[model samples]
Target: MASSRFSAALLLLVPALLAANRPLYAQTVTAGPDSSAVAANPVADSLRRTEKLFGWRVTRPKKAALLALVLPGAGQIYNRQYWKLPLVYGGLGATGYGLYHYQSRYKEYIKGRDLYLAANGRTPINQLPGAGDQVKKETSVDNIQRGIVFYRRNRDTFIAYNALLYGVTILDALVAAHLRDFDISDDLSLRLEPALLPTATTAPTAGLALSLHLK
Candidate 1:
């Protein structure tokens, strides 16, 4: 009877041991909460904050060029390059001088040519007796023609150069304005010095040394 009771107790203890060691499965897991959705992304979050803080905008090159076209060196001034004002004014002055000189020479050529033609017409070519008068008239006509050609060439050259100068001025203004926005910070620096070196001699030897710093 004692053996029978012991066998029944063993059977009951076996089920309890299995229940204690077996893995348990819950019908539903209760997670407290996930907070990653509320956290900010580092790069995007910083960029958004920066955009909101500073009201930075880019300047248009075309607008700056147009401003320069309307007034010489105005765009350079707008770009904060005040030193270029003298150069702009000097270029315009030189071009203006070239135009004036060309105009004066052209007018002189025209007057000289008209006078030569009138003189030739007054004396008929057939009435010239000797080879000398014929040679003189031909020489005068050639001189007047040469003068007109030279004057016209000079005038055209001056006009072309003036146009090129104006175009260059506008281009310079645009480029200056475009470069004004460039970051020009110095982040690194270097220094060199002469140092005394330890030696066997009584006097120390001087040697060059370099030092560098970065930010």
Candidate 2:
């Protein structure tokens, strides 16, 4: 009888102790709704940033554009516009060569501009041993520096043109791929035909008429 009473008293005391400690323990707990939202915000922001950089793009034109930006002719190849590859390569090669050529000339002019002029010198280009005949007309210290500026500007221009061509290649691929599925059969066309009509106050007589119809 004494053991049974001790067991019943232990069970009652355990619940009373837990009830008294519940408030204090709950104060230390951080699994509440506000805390959970705050914790999840960082993960949400990380995923959002990742999505901004590498979101899904499954379209052919989009893929072609990206491929063209990385590789010039690859997009055209993807679009089955193999003939455009030659034009792309040709424009790039020509602009690249022009940029190189102008850069070399600009460097040479810079060197010429830095040379000290002698009192007896007639012209700057004539004073230099290996100067080209092109600068002989404007052969002065100031003129040589000006030529340097001109050639440098030309080099920069060619570089810009080259970049423009690269961007055009990408745009061409995008447009071509986008229009690949467009209808181009004989059923879709314009036909011109002769037509005659009477005006409000005039009769139709030898009037040149035109009509356009498409299916």
Candidate 3:
């Protein structure tokens, strides 16, 4: 008899538990975002923010500038000005080569000058610092000093050239992005037409009329 009572109580409790959970499930479903609302604003839903450098949005002038700053030719690529890439890289490459060449020569001459000065301008040609051939070609203390000055000047000039070229590339990318949508077609034109001009006198004078047409 006690077992029969326990079974009856269990059946009653199970129904009560299921009934309580049903309301909680209904509330959860109701609190969820409405599918209809999401579908209604398709454009707003479709738009999404992307990761960009320095908090700048991609495909903008600032983005182009930032990319150019980070990478040598990145800005031109971003701005779709592929033609300028060759010019930018070529100028940079030439300047870099020149800088290296001049710097190396400057160091060679500097070593030669130090050797000459240490021996009171009487350093032997065989003891000078440089290639065997270069030492033979210019062994005088005066000549070594002149070479040092010349090579240093050229090295500094190439450094400036590299800096200027890098700045130009970045600026070009920014300007190009800003002017991407500008209209420069022949359809937008200015023309001169003959027309009658009203003058202070009673008679009207004929003159050429200049007009601008923007298509």
Q: Which run of 10 residues does model 1 get worst, by summed lDDT?
A: 31-40
| TM match of model 2 to true structure | 0.56
lDDT (10s digit) by residue, model 3, range 2-68: 4345335434643443343221111112221221212222223123223276664454667777889
The CA lDDT at 34 in model 3 is 28
RMSD of 1: 35.6
Consecutive 10-residue window with the lowest summed lDDT within model 3: 23-32
What digit string (tens of lDDT, one per residue) describes model 1 on residues 1-215? 54344335434643443344322222223221211222223333233232111254334555567778898887777667889888778867876787787777667656655655666657543333332332334445566567668768777766766666677667777666545444434887776877777789899898876755434
Better of 1 and 3 by TM-score: 3
Task: List model 2 lDDT by residue over 1-215, tens digit each.
Answer: 54344335434643443343221111222432223212222223233222111366346667778889889988899889999989889878977898899998898776665442543355446656655555555646778778888899888877776776787788778777656644433665454545555678677644544433224
Clashing pairs in 1: none
Lowest-sum lDDT 10-residue window in model 2: 20-29
TM per candidate comes to 0.51, 0.56, 0.64
Candidate 1 deviant stretches above 4 angstroms: 1-58, 121-139, 189-215
Residue pairs in clash, model 2: none
Please report the candidate that would top TM-score against the real structure: 3
Task: Rank the models by lDDT, top first.
Answer: 3, 2, 1
